[model samples]
Every structure is written in structure tokens, then in C-alpha cells.
Target: MKLSDLIAQFITDQLTGQDAVELQRSQLASRFGCAPSQINYVIETRFSPARGFSVESRRGGGGYIRIVRVPMGPSALLQHTVAALGEQVDQSGAQLLLYDLHKAGILGDECFCALKACLGDQALSAVPQPLRPRLRAEMLGAALAALAAEQ
Candidate 1:
């Protein structure tokens, strides 16, 4: 396996049965026989907010990296997912997020269909090509914010 994959798998193993895990980057590098920057790369790529994980790091001698698996509920996960989204998002990513929310019982069938229709490329086809992604992102953000506000 690739070094990054190995590192991600190691962290995944550590995350089982835990809400979060903290480790020293240098220690992980030493354990893997790789440079510390390699650890950073793995964390950045593998533990992304889109993937339902958050990584926070502290610099200096006593600093550590904390990897927290965001709670599985819809509100927290949806907030994290939407907050992490860039100004532009594609259809597949939006669908995946909505699907996750639906499966988690955060969205019912009617709400899911409504949001899916709103996010569809066809629905946004009237907009300029370059602006569609941003529009979709805005719509999603609004929807999520509404959901969050309802609670």
C-alpha cells in the first residue's frame, strides 16, 4: 500500500470506538519511517471535512494534531459538510451530502426529493455555465442553514 494510504488506515484503526484521537505528527512520522510532512499530507487529504473528519493541529514543541470524527447526527454532520464546502460544488457532491442526511434520518423523503430537485443540473440550467456551481452551493447552504435553524 502507498504511504499515505497506510497512514490513513492507521488513523482509521485508531478511530474505531473513539470520538477523537490525538497524536504527535513527529511520532507518526517516526513510526512510519517517513517525514513529518508526509503525515500532514495524509491528514489533509484523507481526513477532510467532506469525509466527516476534522483535523486540528497545534504547532510548537508540545503541539499535537487532533483528529475528531464528527458526530453522526444530521445537524452536526450537515453543518460540517456544508461549512466545509467551497464557493462552488458539483452535482455529485451535493447529492452525496443530501443522501447522507436522508439516510441518517435527518431528511425525509419529501425533503430529500425537494432538495434534490433544487440541486439538479437541469434546474440550474437556466443559469450561466460558470455560475451554476456557485448557485448550487448557495442553494445548498441556504437549505442546510434552514434545517439547522429549525432545530
Candidate 2:
């Protein structure tokens, strides 16, 4: 795996419970010998709800970064469901799946928010009509992967 991927895996492995960890971006950046923005990029790209993880960050001095793991429903079954959808999904279908996830308590408020934001109208609005479905599917998949990883 790439160094970033290794670091990301380490961070994920470190997460053991509901309690979140407060990490300093600069510290991590220093450890990895990369820029702080690189750490941000890793968090933004890897720590997402679809992967079973969520991250909350605070700005300014003494700010803490918290990473939390969300549980997965039906073990690996949901992954099959997501894969079946492929790279294209309609709004109704996405909503229905998300609703199911919410009802199951596999997804919490913050997770819902992150998924919504990713699949939200604003993100979808910018895409061309023909590509919107595929983009939405990719976004959903990424978001779900991030959430699933947290578990």
C-alpha cells in the first residue's frame, strides 16, 4: 500500500470504540513528513461514512480531530447491495437505501448528514444530466465505503 494508505489504515485500526480521538494535524503531518494539507486530503478522501467512518474537526489552537467508527448492518451483505447498484443510481433508490440504513440505526445523524451532503442537490446539480446518475452512484459508493470502514 502507499504510505498514505498505510497511515490511513493505522488511524482506522487505532479506532476501537465510540469514543473519538483528538489528533493534531501538524503532528501527523510531521510524522508522515508531508504537508498538513496532505493529512487533510487523506481524511477527506478516506474517512467517510460509506467506509464506516466519520471525522469531526475543529479549527484553531488546541482544536481536536475526532474519528469515530460506525457499525455495519448485515455484515458484508450491504456491500453486495451497494455493488448491485453499480455506478448509477436514482434519487429515489438512494433515498430508499439511506432510509433503510437510518432505520436500522447503522447510520446516525452525522453520517446521514455527510451522505446527504455528498449526494445532496448541490453536489448533484453541477454534473451534466447524462453523467449525474453515475456520479451519484460513485459518490454514494465512496460515502458508504468511508462509513463502512469506521466499523
Candidate 3:
């Protein structure tokens, strides 16, 4: 497993029967044999709002990082995914979000395949480099908005 996955799993394991886990970043980094920034990277990429987790950090001698698992319903999950897409999305991120929606039963296999194709690199490659992400986001947003409306 990747270091980030390991860190995320470690934090998840700490959340047994709890809403949140609070720990010192430096301490986690030391335990993982990595820099503090690696901890931050894991928190940012893995424990994001889109992934149903919230992260709060304090910086100081007594600083600590807190990770909370957010309970989200179907509508709220779709909303968070849309918001996370923002104004741009790369193929990989788009694919991941679509997979999440699929796993949540918000999307069927047909819809998943369609959205995946629309957001794939091959489809977006026809667009200019600078504008590809935005175009992908717009297409994805339209599709997700339609899904949200159906909900």
C-alpha cells in the first residue's frame, strides 16, 4: 500500500466507535518515518470533504491535527462531489469521483461508463491543454447536476 493509504488507514483505525481522532502531526510523521508534510499530504488528499472526512489543524508547540468522519446522505454526498469538482477536474480525479458515485448507488453501470468516457484523457485531449480540465469539469458538473436533480 502507498504511504498515504497507510496513514489514512492508521487514522481510520484510531476512529473506532469515535467521531474523530486528534493527534500531533509531528508525532504521526515520526511514527511513520516521514516528514510532517507527508502527513499533511495524506490528510489533504485522502481525508478530504469529498471522501467524507473533515480535517482541522492547529500550529504551535501544542499543535494537533484532528480528523473527523463526516456522515453524509446521498444528496449531501452528491453535493460535496460537485463542490469538490469546482471549476476544473483532471481525468483521474473525475474518474475517482464517478467511481464513488457508482459505489454509492447514485450511478448505474451505464451512467458510470458514459461519464468515464466523457472525462477520459482521450476525449479531453482534443481540447487545448489549459482548457481541458475546465471542459471536463463543466461536462461532469452538468451530468452530476442532472443526477442531483433526479434525486
Candidate 4:
């Protein structure tokens, strides 16, 4: 596994049976023999709201990073996710959201993979480059909204 993956796993382990975990950034970096930025990268990519996590951080000598696993019902999760999204969503962001839904048991493996591919870059390749992200966001928003309504 990659260093980032290992770091992410370590942090996730700390959250087992707990809603949240707090760590000093420098200390975590020291434990992994990496820079503080490495910890930040892992937290940003792995613990984002799209993955059902929310993070808070304080910077300074006494600073710490807090990763909170959000527990939400399927319908609520879908609604919250749609609300959290911006005007555009890249393929990776959409995948993150799909993965979160799958993890929450809201989406089956086949459905998740299907949606991922449907919203993927290659599927949108014929569209104009600048327009694809916008179209992707609209498509996902509608799909999630419909899913929420079904719940």
C-alpha cells in the first residue's frame, strides 16, 4: 500500500468504536516519518464529507486535527450530500460520494459501480471539457435527489 493509504488506515483505526479522533498533526507526521502536509493530504482526501466524514483543524503549537465520522440515515445522507455539493463535481468526487453511499448500505455494489461509470470522464468525453463537470454535477444531483425521495 501507499504511504498515504497506510496513514489513512492508521487514522481510521484510531476512530474505531469512536465517533471522532483528535491528533496533533506534527505528532502524526512524526509517527509516519513524513511532513505535516502528508497528514493533511490523507485527511483531506480520505476523511472528506463525501466519504461521510467531517474534519476540524487548529494550527499552531497546540494545534490538533479532529476527524469526525458522520452517522446519517440513508435519506438524510443523500439530502445532506446534495446540499454539500457545489456547481461542479469531478469524477473522483462523484466516486467518493458513491463509495460513501455504498458503505452506508444505501447503494449495492452493482449500482455504485454503474453510477461511477455513468458519471465518469470517459462517459462524458463527447461533451465539451468545461461543460462536463457542470453536466456531471446536475446528473448526480438529480439522481441523489430521486434516491432520497424513494427513501
lDDT of 4 at 130: 95
lDDT of each: 0.84, 0.69, 0.83, 0.88
lDDT of 2 at 14: 69
54 Cα displacement, candidate 1 (Å): 2.3
Predicted model with the maximum lDDT: 4
- Residues 1-151 of candidate 3 have per-residue lDDT tens digits of 9888899889889988999999999999999999999999888667765577767899989999988888987677677667767798888878877876787688899999999997898877778889989899999988887787778
* Model 3 stretches astray by more than 4 angstroms: 22-25, 35-41, 48-50, 56-66
- Which TM-score value belongs to model 3? 0.77
lDDT by residue for model 4 (1-151), tens: 9999999999999999999999999999999999999999899778876577778899999999998888877887788778877799888878877887788788888988889999999999999989988999999999989988999
Q: Give every collision pair in model 1.
A: none
Give the alpha carbon lDDT tens digit for every residue of 61-134 in model 2.
Answer: 77767877655564453564465457777776576667666766777878776776777557678777788778
TM agreement with the true structure for every prediction: 0.63, 0.48, 0.77, 0.73
Candidate 3: residue 119 lDDT (0-100): 88
The lDDT of model 3 is: 0.83
Instruction: Using TM-score, rank the candidates from best to worst.
Output: 3, 4, 1, 2
Regions more than 4 Å wrong, model 1? 1-11, 21-52, 55-67
What's the lDDT for residue 79 in model 4?
Answer: 83
Q: Model 2 off-target regions past 4 Å?
A: 17-19, 74-151
